[model samples]
Target: MSKLSLAELVSMVSETKSEGILRPTTSKDTGRYERTGLAEVVNMQITSGQFIGSRVPEPTYLPPHWSAHIHPEGQLYFCRQGSPRVVTEAYLYRPETLDKVTGWIKRIEKLIADQDFPVSAELELFIKLEDEDCAYYLTISAFLPSFRFRSSTCFARNCIGTMSNFFPMHGSLSRGTLDSLVCVFMHAICDQMTSRVSTFPYSKQDCEAFVSLLKNSRDHLSDGNIVCTVARLWGIICRNRYLTQYGQENSRLSRDQAVLWDPETKNRWVSTVASRISFRTSDRYLAQLDDVFVDHLVYSDQWKSMVTGCLRDWRGASHGAFLALMLHIFLLALTPCPSLAVASASLFVASLLASTLLLNRYVPLQGVTAEQAMDYLEAVQSPTFKFQFVALVFALPHTLNLWGTLVLFANCIFMLATNFGTGFAAGISTVALLAFIAFQWTTSDRFNLSLARTHDKFRAMFFRNPDASYTSEV
Candidate 1:
């Protein structure tokens, strides 16, 4: 097997983008590369289907609503040594998981915490994988998942120099990797997943998953979880590889990644060792994770971010208004262009009104009277920025020219109606004004308005605040 330093490898190839606490994968078809560092060793195979044995027709563990997006295929797997029954969750093998171990440990730790420990829980320790399935009757007591091992969860999320603490074997591969085959399997899942997210990466939905995962974990975005999650994600974005099936004599590409496998192939690496710990493991564990993936974990406050972003845009727009005010003042004092002066002054007044409305909507009354604060809280609790108003406000900024045109048409219509009695020009002018109004209505609604305020479609899409209850305007 060829040995190369990471520094040397980086010079040849590049990494893909990653989210928090996950390692970045490399560019696909960009030639073979292996990542090995201080104390980083894994038992993997670089063979033509020799190491990972044949397929099983049935799945070892199948949860309801399990999709390829979770565990590519469902079947039982045997480890190189003993092939002890492997029990795992699909999220543990999901491709977008920035840090697989972070999610995995979180899921397990929560399980451990809730359980009545020392009384063999129906759980499997990932550390061991014997050849025969159920040949070893191990209990929750057999697993040494104490709070002391929490540090290792932190270690798994970290990259490079920090990882040495987990393995601590700065040695040659000829003696084999530091961890067992099962450890290699888990790390392989992480490595495979990073490649998919990093290389062809796009959109907030792509990377925001890491944020949700970290938040949902037992640490619940604890300081260490956040830090390590960041490290792993950045590492993946920067295209870091793991040495899972590396240093093999043949040097072929490792087909161990679950992401690349077809359903049949994916199913073969199937066995997951689940605890018969109780009804919790057998019945509710899968449902609980399902809840997190579908609903609870996705619970976040998007309204806060949306409001803050809109405020920032408005603040910038305010500067433009200030400039317009100055221009109006200059024209009014120095220039002979009275029409332009009048128009500019009118614009300045309208801007001030708009700003005041926004300010009042956002800020509470300065006075500390009991009523004012209560009113403020009440206003906040009940959203005043209904979809139509939001649309109108956003549309209002771009409507200056349209309003100007409409005003000119109205003036013509008024003069004609007063003298000419609905003559040709007056009729045409009225039509023009109506057309402009129609245009504004359609354009604004297209961007921000939701016609059915009862359901609050737009607000639900863009104005969700987890803490605030939404009462429909309709």
Candidate 2:
């Protein structure tokens, strides 16, 4: 028998993938352009068909620390993440071009580094956005050190609080929060010379990263380079507006429309992004991107494959949390075995506390003020979880069977306390994993502060009744 060549094997695989089982007859799996062919168009250019040159223009000397945080995604941008934090008053209703807004942002970042904002600077600017950390993302990134906020969606500060809630980890939330100061407050703020810090909730990574991605170019971006590149990317997206699912009033431009930066599309895109200066004065610009398209097209990635990946991660997180919850209840049932009960309860309660705190942080509540945001932060910063742990313990046991469970619960808590010393190292790792997974699982919007959806999800999960899938715009 003749051995099959590599080419033959690949051809077979490609054919099989094209003919997806039970796929609609209308589907054309074997289109002329294959995945690799499309990738070549987006990622690589040919040098006389001999050598493949990268289409992306990334910088070469990226710091060792920053290397890991970089995601070299192409054909899309992170702006589509839909503004995770709060977009404060300054940016709203300001008909500023992308050039003007980005210039202002750069000025702020530069001033922050210099630590000296001149009196002339109208400096107070904030783009507040909210982000939900979810399960699959956290689990995948769990092994990083205490500063895992970027590497994992897990907030390191929560590890101690969650762990101490059930098992009394010798570590304090104050210390954990303090220790993770770099990740929480200082990651992306570093100079280009510093090691790269990972940015989490990947969708909302700074425009610096998005700039490199849009160029299909090198890593190790400078501030100037990032601005110019991102400006161009924004321009390109505008040029290709018809391609987007976003409904433009006149979707078809006859290569003659003069809007948003310049008479020609190419000039319009690049003119706004200035690396060395503040917002440039310009006349021709689009009136507004349709508000209806903002969430999906303007602020979020609209790719099908990426969309599918999101759903998968969302479900994984939810299931992971549900599993942890079930295990907690199971351990409650096993309270007769003090050692076993204490160990299992530690995992569940830690996860429960972590999820609760994440909910408090991300889910918006009516009438929230900046003061309340501070209050939330301070509450999480507390060094001890003893009160929370004891309160939770007292609440759960009596609901099952008053007398026997009460006795078992008392014995377990007592034994746990007597045996517990600050198991700081052990506590951090355990709770970090559990909290990361549980928090990510719970924060997806369907069940996140969404009363009706949360109700349906729990009922379906526990009662064998199913509900329609919920997908959020952000």
Task: Looking at model 2, report the run of 10 residues with the lowest lDDT sum.
Answer: 163-172
What lDDT tens digits, residue by residue, belong to model 2 across residues 1-474? 344332232223223321121111111121212334333355555577675655654553321211111122222111211111111212222334333434433433443334432222111122221121100111111122321111112233433111100110111122232323224323333422253212121233443565345344333233333333333333333323423322655442221233233222333333334211111111111112122122122222212222233234334433454464565565565444656555544544443454445344344522344234335434532233212222232222211222223343455554454456436435654675698688766775755668777677787886553433332212
Tell me the lDDT of model 2 at 326: 67
List TM-scores for all candidates, in order: 0.24, 0.16
Q: Which runs of model 1 end up more than 4 angstroms from their true locations?
A: 1-144, 147-348, 356-379, 383-409, 412-424, 427-474
Q: What is the lDDT of every predicted structure here?
A: 0.34, 0.31
- TM-score (C-alpha) between model 1 and the true structure: 0.24
Q: How close to the true structure is residue 81 of candidate 1, measured as C-alpha lDDT?
A: 15
Cα displacement (Å) at residue 217, model 2: 38
